[model samples]
Target chain A: MLFVFTYAQQKGTAKNPFILNPTDSTVVWGSYWSEMPPVLHIHSGDYVRVRTVLTSNPEHLIKAGVPANQIEKQLIAVQAVKDRGPGGHVLTGPVFIEEAAPGDVLEVHIDSIDLPIDYGYNGIGQGGFLSDEIFDRKTKIIHLDREKMLGHFADGIEIPLHPFFGSMGVAPPKKAGRWNSAPPWIHGGNLDNKELVTGTSLYLPVFVKGALFEIGDGHAAQGDGEVDITAIETSLIGKLHFIVHKGKSLQWPRAESATHIITMGFDRDLNAATHIAVRQMIDYLMQTKKLSEADAYMLCSVAADVVITELVDGNVGVHVMLPKYIFVSH
Target chain B: MLFVFTYAQQKGTAKNPFILNPTDSTVVWGSYWSEMPPVLHIHSGDYVRVRTVLTSNPEHLIKAGVPANQIEKQLIAVQAVKDRGPGGHVLTGPVFIEEAAPGDVLEVHIDSIDLPIDYGYNGIGQGGFLSDEIFDRKTKIIHLDREKMLGHFADGIEIPLHPFFGSMGVAPPKKAGRWNSAPPWIHGGNLDNKELVTGTSLYLPVFVKGALFEIGDGHAAQGDGEVDITAIETSLIGKLHFIVHKGKSLQWPRAESATHIITMGFDRDLNAATHIAVRQMIDYLMQTKKLSEADAYMLCSVAADVVITELVDGNVGVHVMLPKYIFVSH
Candidate 1:
């Protein structure tokens, strides 16, 4: 209820949105527990301007050469949350959506992502794709150029900036108990898929009452595989609009960008992950395009692109992006 | 000697170029052998318009419901090739480039690719990503709309047309002796990579004197993974200009699209293959971008994209594409 005053001050009504900032009581670290209580209650179609912080501690950021003045006070403040757990990511909520029960779908419309931070860091340690062969355990501090929308990577090199949340999900099935935030599954945590940028709508299936949802692990920019096990890890603020679809169901999380329909899968083996993505795509085509199973499978081979999302997570990921333009005039 | 009259009439000299069509005597199916003699000899800076035929048997194409007239007559005539592969692909070369010796780099300038065929096929077979689970080994014949540059994949589905030669490479090292054309290696054979479309230049490391170059396995369009183990496998013709860089040396094949510099790797293990691609990209950045090993490694994580080229090739493939736009004013 601490957010009530802030919500009212921001003129948050049933029709209007409010702001949710990370604080000691509002943020959870490392793992997701189904038993965790919600800190806020909101109705469907509500827009929340939420602010999330990177998992790195303020001490670490400053040690990595980030200026103290640039560090968000909220990040330093959240360090008092002693409940931090078995994992490392710091997530920002379990917002309980009223009437969102099991079997429902949570449609997250990512309206905007604002980047106010000027720096981030990429650390290379253990568990990366090539970590065994090339063990260079080091971290590089990358400065972001807001005007050019790029990262000053080296003396003569620059990287394009595409900001997005690397992790977002609801509570897992009750029987699963506490879940680590390291791997993404049916709950969709730590997807680390770069395609989930702004203007994308991620449809995640609801598994519990109220459909408690949380988001964090921001990336300033990342390549497809995240081969080194890190991106331009940074903090990001998002304005998200949530809609609860009561009748629809989805086996795997799906996403839609401005120009394409996206599907995802995660598995220990990259080959199996690829298979799951392709099959999900075929299922999507069969239902939406009204094509026979045979036709959908063939179309996937000739049309849709299945790309590696991340290879470092315990469960590597692969996603399918089928351009919406290809389904025109139907 | 047999092609002397044809070469002279077409003015196929050091500066000028001529066409080489696939015939029973000119084409080699499947395996690539270093002992294979060159069918044509040309100098550096020379252009060759190479025509290739699909490896499908004409009778099988007709049985799969493809119109008989749509089958290339050259495909029918190539049945007499007793040297037809220990593999399944039909390649149309062994074009020796004079002075192209080991430690040199052969720059293949792909000026254009013409898709004159009206049809192609996608076959799902064993060894595919999902073959063991989804055992529907059927072939689909797709019709091309030349005017629209699209493939009619289904009753209401249309796929954007992108034509390119799937198999194109030089001879492997002499020590390797006979090599199957199913996988790509230092020789770059059967690199089912779709990024090598029109206007893309492929750079292959020359392995022996008079680099024995071969090209075939055309595709009308394909997704990244080629999950079902095939694309719109079609016959295509490519106009390529070869330039021998006598001083340049490379360890693996590389390519460049209009907007990005590309690196590639192939291995049976996807993880190992990805490692190879990333290392090659790091090597590229260190050499061309003048970056230190640490800077190049960090730049790859922050900038370059590592994508799965194909999962079904005997040696699966991965490629890295670093966009050219990010390097401006540097």
Candidate 2:
């Protein structure tokens, strides 16, 4: 199934780009709707700087007795309209990229992610991933010390901050219908991987033409599993550059940082997802490094690390990391 | 079903201890037989210096054309007897520790692991964890550089060597029969976790009186999954001190390094194992830190990292690592 995009006039520049604000009417709430209109249009190799608010409601925070001063002004200003769909994350965008077509790959290079505020929240509810194991619901507001690059979790506990977008994806195949922004799939929505921080490139398979790329769910810091269903949830402004690789098709999303190449897989079964990720890494090694299949598989066993991105997402996420230093040259 | 151990005269001092050689008659191939006799006996708090060999036949390596000069003399002298059953791991002991009983916990402090030889092998067989994905059986010999702490896998690929015992466990519950040494259970055998290196303490639930602890299957280096079913398998001498916790109980094996506390879980289902590990971490936080369940769970989400130890083992292994720096004055 193909998706036809009615492109809008391009406005963002390579250096000083047009900002897609979360407060704008173009913001999507909860679900990734393939039919959604493109909020902005950009060509491949162009830059688009965007802003995203945490997936929370000012009314809910106020009702829960958070002081008015503690609430982010942006949170208060953004209208919480109920017209969105089947999920709960407040995502920003659906930026249509010119020349990105089906059977191609979209490469997103994350330049920087900046936190506008010095606070964030982590919430655990009865509907969390480990709800069967833990049956309580609570919220914790954490103070971020930007200078120290730490999140003050408690009086003496601190967490190192590695800010990144938890969700970054293109619209799925037109046949998949409107998808929830919770579970990641072939199109790579809500990956919730902490390793995709600054200086990393995320590659997603483009199933639809123009590649309606959306980004949201910012986290200041998060451990691997995201077991409690939330991270240091906060709003963020990110500088991103996009490039489309025509004729390069992928079955699942993959990423690369300075030190490592990453392969990802998502499925309801954790084992199945893990296998997919491992196979993808094996494929990458064989294709890129010119290693035999046996050598690639063995190399993975002795060198690659597989990690769970998030268990709470309906389709559990797994990623295999192969350190680049092992290769003679890249 | 209880197997009584006839104790031998203890000979080792806390500082200078007796060594249990893997080639001695005491070594057992494969299954952890409760009925097997202890090679040595020691009191709680006493130190035991032990030696282990890789789980490959010297004849096989020689037939594969490894030069006779390259093979360690000990490997050639150690006769590969045919009295092994159920599994194929060449485990070195069932060291009897006095005063360790069922319901107690055995705390094994790993003082050091040193390579006696400068080589190791990684093998993948048709019966491996990913056998369906990969059919060929192969072996790759690696050169270990002790001074550099690296395993030279190939011309340019160097794996950082983190030597640790792959299997460390006491005798299983007597009624469980002779258990194969492949899967890790409540008694903790073949965990294959790279984090259980020197200076770490592995805590295993005692299932038999005297805690017939055995250790073997050394690795110079290994990644998380052990996907090809082998690490940098090698022989090493390890110095370990044992202490029996009188009343402390644990449902699964737990460990602590200088920087983190680790909780483990094992199950046929990866997701189920992950849940068990996460729940164990939450329990650990609640009990030790005096935090509410909700807060503990949230803390885990923000600070703890859950990793896959190995997937090839019959019961897949998962471990949750909670960094100790997050706790104040622990």
| Top TM-score model | 1
> What docking class should model 1 receive?
medium
Looking at candidate 1 chain A, the ten consecutive residues that score lowest on lDDT are: A5-14
lDDT per residue for candidate 1 within B1-330, as digits (tens), equals: 365544253235334466889988888788666778888888887889889987588998999998788778889888888876667898998888886998999988888888868888988868677777667788888888878998887665788989988899998999987789888898899898889998899999998888899999999999887878888988898889888998998988999999989999999998788888989998998899887676677777777887888888899999998888778673
Candidates in order, TM-scores: namely 0.95, 0.94
Scored on chain A only, each candidate's TM-score is 0.95, 0.93
State model 2's lDDT: 0.86
Cand 2, B chain, TM = 0.93
Fnat of all models, as shown: 0.57, 0.74
lDDT of 2 by residue, B198-240 (tens): 9999999998888899898999988898889889999988999
lDDT of 1 at B181: 88
Instruction: Please tell me how candidate 2 rates in CAPRI terms.
Output: medium
| DockQ for each model | 0.61, 0.52
